[model samples]
Target chain A: MRTPLGKVRNHGAGAAGTGHFIAQRSTAIALAVLAPWFVVNSALSLKGGNYLGAIDFLTQPLNAVGVILLVLIAFYHMWLGMQEVILDYIHRPFTKVLLLLLNTFGLIAFGAGAVFAVLMVNFGA
Target chain B: MAGATRPQRPLSPHVQVWRWHVTMLTSILHRVTGVALYGAALGLALWLMAAAAGAEVFGPTHEFLLSPIGQVALYLIVAAVAYHLANGIRHLVFDSGAGLQPADASTSAWFAIFFAIAAPIGLWALVTFGG
Candidate 1:
């Protein structure tokens, strides 16, 4: 009974890196930079003490930029990071591809809705 | 007989047959919670953008969230947010190169559960009591 050389060899090379691991860390750094400013903006919103007061504060030049930045960064972060999670555990290839497309559309829809909202806030319509 | 016993297996049978571990549960739940949070986040993204945009867009969503079903959805989102946020901090800690030990892994898992549950309760109290 001879043991084959192939049997002695191992099979560990298939372990690979995915986009989620990298993107999550990348967006982690972005969130660290963005979160504090957002906290301050949130506090400011409360301070307005009334609807139009809140509206006026939101319409400020810097505040508008901050809100836009927050939406864009946050959605990008969520999309990329979540794409990673779906790919990892949901092993069926078709389901995985479907999820990827669903996620992409989801992000786009979110972006559109947000843009619409920003337009409403900025233009007061 | 003890020494002569059949050579023990190098690894446990069925990494599948292995006990459902805390670390494993935490790892999976972190990702699961992430998907839930993404839905909630889409809502938040709109809210922020609407805030930027003004009343026409903002009012309806604001009103929607305050409604009964919307409140329930909002509550779930709040729960997801609390768990994800706390678990995220745990990942950050691991990213920093701490908690590599087996004991540390289990400790962190417990911590994740504790924080996940506690944050929501705290938030629930504040939302109900503060308002």
Candidate 2:
């Protein structure tokens, strides 16, 4: 049970503390498995290639799906990591709050843009 | 407590006060790489957008990536990723309640550092020379 002071100070997790921790790690584990594949495949796809070839490779259903997953998960993980870093290092309360908001919004925008790009490629739009 | 003025707190010991060590280097590198990856997200998004947008956009993007400066950037990013990934695995190992021994921890840090160097170099060797 949180008191008024706790609520005012934002002491509680707003029901997200444990879930955020678990999700960050889960995404990290997922990335650990996916990242090597991503790097290798990306390099291979681009071997002696031009722009259209790059598009062709990415638009393939398998590559498109893999990339979409990678972008979303990576951004989510990045957001969590950035939030932690900012909270740890930024001592000014106002600046910390601003940076935290920027981190969240910025990641969301990147994730949305990346997924949109992948979908555009997938659909040949 | 919320309404009262807070007392000034002592700053914790940081890198300035500490001697260099492999484990400390690894830890700092993890955070640094994490921040770099966050910035790289924008580059990635731009790459994807260009790809989806067609050759007019992707041509320049791909060209930049193959250029000397771009290749250098790519190599650094890849190195960062390798380090972060390898150290992340070490962290997971620690989380599992193993590798708590100082000797084992140092060994793992060295392993992570070695992997960070080797992974990108090995990857590029394959990319460049593999038939």
Candidate 3:
């Protein structure tokens, strides 16, 4: 399976592959628990059209932390999943790499923005 | 990088070529739902930012969620989550080296489909009718 270029690279899909697999599954397990809580919390928060109350509910320490964890994990998991999809469907090499890079940057930017928002709300910033 | 003289490469069986089966359909839907969830995550991030920006921002965000289109979108997201979660658990089981047998795999695929639809609809009904 060694191409001359791969031989020059010297490492296979070893540790990185394991880490990727573990991350996907662990996030899956975490979301299985967190997603339900998220849906229910969102429903209760916004159901009555009390926007301030909804903000207040999210600002509560536990709920704030939960939303942060949920968004962070969800975004990371999303990047991994999208990577797989792009790799499968985007057969052209350069375009595929470009798309993958875009996916990574997009996820990081959004995840950071979300976590920041949660903190701002929590601290009244 | 040239295209005109590129050698013919063997292509794998795809939707147009393959006969459909439960596992095949489930596999495709899993990827579709995952992609859908990625878009949903962006909306979630924006919503969080809006809420953090105070009432002026949160008002429109809240109104959007209660709007008819938002309600429909929310319900679709709920269904997508349910299906993805159910299939993801099945994937984990397969990763553990169980459920790889044809019969078991088919059964689980069907189960995932059922659970995905039923869970979201059931929740929608409860939320709509209950307090």
Candidate 4:
């Protein structure tokens, strides 16, 4: 009974559909490289769970920058992926909205805290 | 407003309905590993924060990471990471419009699962023997 335009108006695209898809894939690609690097480096450096070794590794400029980028991109990707999971599964109106909001704010806070921590280590602040 | 009047819609095939298949396992595992890695990511955040807090604060965290339970947790995290990484690459291939064939998808899923099993053991060997 509805017009074609009416049927499609609220359903298609949702404005950011393509953008979300692209960001998720692009970040996945970035992680594909960064993650392996991180795992290998951590294994080699943090042997015996050497705390000073970790500090030493993070203090290097390249390592510091890489960790920072990894944290930022990983958290951003997590935000996007978790949003999809939440939207797909969490059907209750109130819980879905609540989780979506918490997901965003919590990730931002954690991501920022991580980056700040890395910066503090690198800069001796 | 229309909710009360809307007819009940059929839902998509869910886990209980689908036949067991490698692709299905991979699909489910991709999400499961993703959630697991979400927790791992939080652990990463905590590690960074503790490291920043200086040796006095980081001591317990580091000790725990080296303990028996922590090592098991770390191994599981690594396994999840390996699986997620390999399966994530498979997904990227799927996104690129390749490997959509059932056989190919199944093959890749098996490969991912194999890699997940092998990576942690390989790392353990490298650390224990390559020294």
Candidate 5:
């Protein structure tokens, strides 16, 4: 029995599965640590009361880096999570192919958008 | 007996029927937390796009975020963040082939429960003290 309190047992699921699970979890843990910072930074950002001011605040170390890292980690974790969902739900040959394609492209888009926004902030200032 | 026979419906692996266990609860909570966090991510995206695009968009998004509904949603999202994180570690142990025994399952499950609760409470305290 795979009980949490007893002496830990082996999952016997093999290295490939364990590796995927571990990676999904590792990114998720990073995201968990990062989430509050992003939320608080976001909530505080609205206080400045103007476009330029919001931009200005984001230029600050805490907000700028907070947002940049937030975007990367969030998207990475999400991509990993979504891939599992797609694998479970989409069983067709062609549709699964497309969904996999979409997941990869979507993550890339998210990363690019985040980088673009940060660059804009830095250069626009 | 035939006259009194009852039909049995297919059951999804839901809360009922199965004996409730900590690992099971934590597993369900992880999925719940994940979906909730997705919604939160959407809200974040809106706010980000607004901030990037300028005041015309930022004004409405900002107002919504500070509203009662928005705040509640924000709170749930953060709470889910905590749950998912803690539960995620439990999963990590399972992933690493370390916590598959029933006793270890219970122990790690409790550990996740405590960790999850601690984080959101910490966030709420931050909001109360600072916001």
Candidate 6:
């Protein structure tokens, strides 16, 4: 049943084995920088559960940009990681496909919503 | 392919079959914390959206985030992030084809666990008392 060419290339169904690997690693590297900065900065700025402080922090141009980048990259990374988990464990074809779809679209929607919110706060929309 | 005629396949050893080790734990916890962070990201989005909706919306959201239950959730998210960050770096090092030796790998795994526990407590103390 094996096509010699298919066996030789062996890229699996996606035909891009290394793409996921590279994307995950690159995002991990970016998060290594972004996550720590966001955590420490938020910890300092948002102490006392200061609601107004959080709004002010997000309104700053640099901080707003950082938050948007964090949400996008973090959501992308989450999608890739969840995709792996679902593929590895979920054996039913239908369930697997459904989950994979939800994982991608859900993260995109959430990420877009977050970015939109940040822009709103910054632009006073 | 559908019945007893189906060929039996050799199955890989799973968690229940393997003896526990720090490396095994770090590997599992990386995924676990990753899933936890997924929820945290959703919370982040909701919080931001609430903030953008003005104080009437954020007021209650912020209060919930500061409530006892919310603090517990935040603490756990902090812990998850800490562990995932530490172990993730270990994995990146592993990707580079270095530190794969059992001793070095386990050492890094332990360090990651330690940091995960300590970082949140340290952060809490700093925020609570370091005024």
In terms of lDDT, model 2 sits at 0.86
- As for candidate 2, its interface RMSD to one decimal place is 1.1
Local accuracy of candidate 1 as per-residue lDDT tens digits, B30-123: 7877777677667677666756655676677667766789767855665665566666777888888988788988997888788767755665
Q: Which lDDT tens digits does candidate 6 get at residues A37-124?
A: 8887888779776668888999888899899999989998999999999999999989999999999899989899999999998888
Model 4 stretches with alpha carbons more than 4 Å out: A1-13, B1-17
Worst 10-residue lDDT window, candidate 1 chain B: B122-131
Candidate 4 lDDT, A10-125, residue by residue in tens: 75544668899999999999999998888878787778757789899899888899899999999999999999999999999899989999999999999999999999998877
Clash-forming residue pairs, model 6: none
Where is the poorest 10-residue window by lDDT in model 5 chain A?
Answer: A1-10
**Cα misplacement distance, residue B84 of candidate 6 (Å):** 0.4
Candidate 3 scores an fnat of: 0.70
Q: Individual DockQ of the candidates?
A: 0.32, 0.66, 0.62, 0.63, 0.22, 0.66
For model 5, give the RMSD to the true fold: 9.1
Cα lDDT tens digits, model 2, B26-71, are 8999999999978877798889988878878888888898899999
* Alpha carbon lDDT at A68, candidate 5: 77
Stretches of candidate 3 off by over 4 Å are A1-15, B1-17
TM-scores for all candidates?
Answer: 0.68, 0.88, 0.87, 0.89, 0.72, 0.89
- Clash pairs detected, candidate 3: none
Query: What is the RMSD of candidate 6?
Result: 5.5
Judged by DockQ cut-offs, the docking class of candidate 1 is: acceptable
Chain B TM-score against the true chain B, candidate 1: 0.74
What class would a CAPRI assessor give candidate 3's docking? medium
In model 1, the number of clashes is 7
Query: By descending DockQ, how would the candidates be arranged?
Result: 2, 6, 4, 3, 1, 5
